[model samples]
Target: MKRSERLVDFTNYLLNHPRKLTTLSFFSERYKAAKSSISEDLVIIKRIFDETEVGTVETFAGVSGGVVFTPAISDKNSQEIASEIAALMGESNRILPGGYIYLSDILGSPKNLDKIGKIIAHEYVGKQIDAIMTIATKGIPIAQAVSSILDVPFVIVRRDPKVTEGATLNVNYMSGSSSKVENMTLSKRSLAPGQRVLIVDDFMKGGGTLNGMKSLVHEFDCLLAGVAVFAEGPFKGERLISDYKSILKIDSIDVEKRSIDVTLGNIYTEEK
Candidate 1:
């Protein structure tokens, strides 16, 4: 293949397989090019990736060495995306009957989900994240997006158990929004002991559900990598959890007036 064709194919492969190691030999053999040529191509690809703020290409040395692509978005891009989402969420028409904001449209959009995933995945880059965990329903799309970018598996935590999942582990916790006790279940096979799990959710009010997921993580003998949410609403009482990241913060929702105050969340302010 021509150098131009090889560069395009090489860049595509790295982007698709983020965080996965591809040895120089593999690329050399695949492209029918010398290892030296492959190394030179990687230098060009890495420079472009850096300049574009898409991600980073990490190359290692020696016989066992290889290259891995780690996906990331620049802070400027992350801020722009988060700000746009917050603005969209602030529209009066998005408010529901009970002061809840409608986010199905944003979450369902592939374009939006891809951006959201990139922002979230960028935060966890270089961290040891085994899997992305989220509740059933709304959070699935967000988790799936992040999982794809991180090249990891995502597991769903459901309110109701499914027979198809076989044996499950259950945890009961207070509902953040409803203020009632609720049960959440996860398949025992979803996570293994000592795995580092990141908890993700579409929305968080009182953080009770997130707390429950934290407990489930402990139950599985796994470590809590971190918590991330699409948006967080104001809670009347003290929140159950404090250390968490959110893309957007719903400052206030005036149901009667149909107005919402949306702003960027801690995702930007938090230490990198």
Candidate 2:
């Protein structure tokens, strides 16, 4: 194949299989090219990836060394994506009763989900993450998108236990929004002891649900790597959790006026 064709194929493979190591010999053999030539092609690919701020192509040294692609989005791009989402959410028609904003359309969009995934996944790129965990239903897409980019498995936490799950672990947590106690469960086989987990959700208010997931992680003898969410709304009482990240912040909602104030969340403002 021509050099251009080889470069296109090489880039596509690395992107589709993020975090998977590929030896130079594998590419060399696949492309029917010399080792030196393959190495040179990697350099070019790495340069383009870095210049575009899409991700990083890491090259390992030694006999067993290989290349791994880590997907990332620049702060500027992250800000742009967040701002766009905030605008979409700021519309008066999106405001629902009880201080809630309509999010089904935004969360359901493939374009929005892909960009949100990249922004959140970029935060935990180099961290040791064994599995992505999220509550069942809305948070599933966000978790799945991040899982795909990180090339890691994602597990779901359900409100009720299923017999198909076999042995399960359960945790009781206070619901932030309703100020009521709630129960959540996880399959015992979903996570192993000592595995690091990242918790993600579609929306957060009072952090009751996220706190419940944190407890489940502890119950399973796993470490909590971090927490990320698509959007966060104002919590009247003290929040259950403090340390977390969000793509957009729902600053204020005027039910009477039919308006919502939205802005970029700490994920964009925090120092890298």
Candidate 3:
């Protein structure tokens, strides 16, 4: 292949496998090029990646070394995206009867999820995340988004039991939104012991559900890598989770007036 063709192919290959290492010999053999040539191509690719803020390609030295592609977005880009999302989410027409904001459209959009996933994945980059865990309904999209970017499997925590999943481990906890006790179940075989799990959810009011997920993680003997909520709404009382990160924060919701105060959450301030 010509050098131009090889560069395009090499860049595509690395883009497909974020945070994965591919040896120099493997690339050299695959491209039918010399080690020196492959190294030179990587330098060009790495420069493009850094300049674009798309991601970074780190080349390690040694027998066990190769190159690993890490996905990243600049703080400025992240803040811009978050600000746009906050404005879009604050529309009064999206308010439900009970002061809840409608976010299905945003969550369901592939374009939106793509940006959301990239933003969330960027935060957890370099962390030892084994799997992404989320509840069955709304959280699935966000979990899938993050997992896809991180190149990891996502596990769903269900409110109801399904026989198809075989045995399940169920945990009971308070539902922060409804203020009612609820049970969440996860497949016993879905996760292995000692895995580092990142819990993600679409919306959080008081974090009751997220807390339950944390308990479930302990039940499976897995470590809690982190917790992330797409958006957090103001709760009546104290929130159960304080350490979790949120993409957007709903400061106030006035049902009568149908107004929402939305702002970029702590992730932008903390990370950026």
Candidate 4:
């Protein structure tokens, strides 16, 4: 593989698997390259990430040397934990077809969304979170719930710029499945500089929307307190987010049986 391509792939692998590091020898064997070459690649990638204020690359030196990506906030420590996620995911639900699932009921129920939202807000209760963001079609209600509990503002990420909006910014992200770039937009004045934000969504399929939201937050010169998703979909191959929380992880949706399988996500245990 070309050096440039290998570097890009290496970074993607780490970003997709934060806190999971593979040794240099592993990469050396996989790429059939010298250890020195791999080391150079890691340095280049780490520098690029730090300069952009995107990610952090830490290298453990010694007999079991490896690299790990540690996000400022990890899902495992979110107000909600993974074991709790499994319990919620245990319930079955209706699946229409083509792997598409309808979750309108969950989003609309204030009580249900409230419990989940509060769990997420609890983590940022004193973090000075300025607002919550969610991408429309499905995430609006959940975002609103979290915003209410946090007593903060809420911003919606639109699929396209509406005529009524005065000014907006657009960002392109790799769709979770297709890997094709899609556009999501938000009003320019929604988030202010030096503001802290908590990103919330109804579902996290591929984290494409999360990445887009992160980019949008960056454009507004805001800081991200964290991200929380009601449910996480399968396919955890190349995720763009690191610090996040998910209540449930759907294993499978049995459309014919009207049942669904789910598991717990990262839950916060320590007192924040």
TM-score of 2: 0.97
| Model 1 agreement with the true structure over 180-267: per-residue lDDT tens digits | 9999999999999999999999999999999999999999999999999999998888899999999998888899989998889999
TM-score of each: 0.98, 0.97, 0.97, 0.64
Model 2: CA > 4 A from native: none
Point to the candidate with the largest lDDT.
1
**After superposition, which runs of candidate 3 have C-alpha atoms over 4 Å from their true positions?**
none
Ranking by lDDT: 1, 2, 3, 4
lDDT of 4 by residue, 229-263 (tens): 88887775877776677767677877777777776
RMSD (Å) of each candidate, 1 decimal = 1.0, 1.2, 1.2, 17.7
What are the per-residue Cα lDDT tens digits for candidate 2 across 1-272? 78899999999999898888889889999999998888899899999999998799999988989999989888788888889888999999998888788899998998899999999998887898999999999999999988988889999999999999988999999998888999999999999999999999999999999999999999999999999999999878799999999999998999999999998998987775
Q: What number of clashing residue pairs does each candidate have, in the order they appear?
A: 0, 0, 0, 13
lDDT over C-alpha atoms for residue 134 of model 4: 88
As for TM-score, the candidate ahead, 1 or 3, is 1
In model 4, which runs have C-alpha deviations exceeding 4 angstroms?
Answer: 1-93, 255-258, 268-272
| After superposition, candidate 1 runs with Cα above 4 Å error | none
Estimate every model's Cα lDDT from 0 to 1.
0.93, 0.92, 0.92, 0.74
Which candidate comes out best when scored by TM-score? 1
**Model 3 residue 255 lDDT score:** 89
Q: What value does the lDDT take at residue 2 in candidate 1?
A: 81
**Model 4 C-alpha lDDT versus the unseen true structure:** 0.74
Q: Is candidate 1 or candidate 2 better by lDDT?
A: 1
Poorest 10 consecutive residues by lDDT, candidate 4: 71-80
